[model samples]
Target: MNALKHSLAGLAAALLLAGCGALPDKPARAALYDFGPGSTPTATAGAAAPRALPMIALAEVDANSRLDGTQLLYRLGYADSNELRPYGQSRWSQPPAQLLRQRLREALSAGHTVLGPEESATIARTEGRLPDTLRVTLEEFSQYFEAPDRSVGLVRVSATLTRSQPGGDKVLAQRSFTARKPAPTQDGPGGVKALAASSDAVVAELVAWVDAPR
Candidate 1:
């Protein structure tokens, strides 16, 4: 009878000790944000919209490069399940084709001429960050996806700009912009947010370049 009582007491003590050693539950992860074309442009109070200046009409880049659209290509996604063939699956934060179309529309909107899907528009000016005009290419596009929040993207563009004059079309400018984004904490949403941030840099630089006196 005494042994049974002792065992019961010991079991109760063990339960209490186990309860004391238990860990608290972790916080639930938040739902990430994923904007379609990244975040929308924000205009500050008293700040005027970008000037719509005259420029050359842009031509569609050739398909020599592995770009999905005009000048947009995304690095492949990571597949957690496949440890061996890690790159077996690719998950794009945004569709490269769609993103390029949106970005091109936005960039051209800043200029004097309107951009459209049709090729009827006269060639006002050609603008891209590729190495060659007729055969521009996007060399490197690196992306990193992280946990708990955010994604970082590094875009390297190389292009050749060709302009059409009375004399004929000629190559104007060619260069690359290595746009980088700091860590974002919103998972899928974070990528778009980061893209918007990165796009801002590109737009600012392009604006200054176009605004500069020829």
Candidate 2:
């Protein structure tokens, strides 16, 4: 009777285990966006025209990644740094791509004529490219840690700005802007936030340069 009872108990435990599914691992949180170029100012309808409007062509921006194997998609986070050591958990948040498109649209519309405007159809038909324009491309963006103390970041951007006829394809004005900012704090989020702010500064400078007089 005792042996029979033990066998029944083992069978009950096995059945219970089979009913429960395996637990899943924790999700990997991503922190992206927070880099370069904030929102653009609104433009009034039928606003007074400036001296000249430039047709601008904006290319895609790029960045380095710490987590993902590919560099195409990356979040705002820390890479191995010389000055600062890793601390705490790695946590990140990224904005949608639509935000970038909106920012670019706003920035360009502020003081320049963006490409593909219905009113500017004549301009495009006349000139192949815009005048006094900028094309921004991000080359190297990463955060460096100062061991046991602080952190810093470097943002390298390349911009091709020019002035020429719509279809002439000539270069009038061009320059490149590089900005570096030291981390405000050692905390992970704080450091990442600072870098993101620096990125915006870089973009703003690029826009201003493109719009400035040659």
Which predicted model would earn the best TM-score? 2
Error of 1 at 184 (Å): 1.6
- C-alpha positional error of residue 114 in candidate 1 after TM-score superposition, expressed in Å: 2.8
Q: Tens-digit lDDT track for model 1 on 1-214?
A: 9999999999999999899889677766444322254446687899876675654344443332343422222342444412211121233444343444355446656644543323323232353312112223444343454433435655554555565456765766666655778546433444545655665565455445544564
lDDT of 2 by residue, 29-80 (tens): 5444344456544899997876555566554443333321212121233443
Model 1 vs. true fold: TM: 0.50
TM-scores, each model vs. reference: 0.50, 0.58
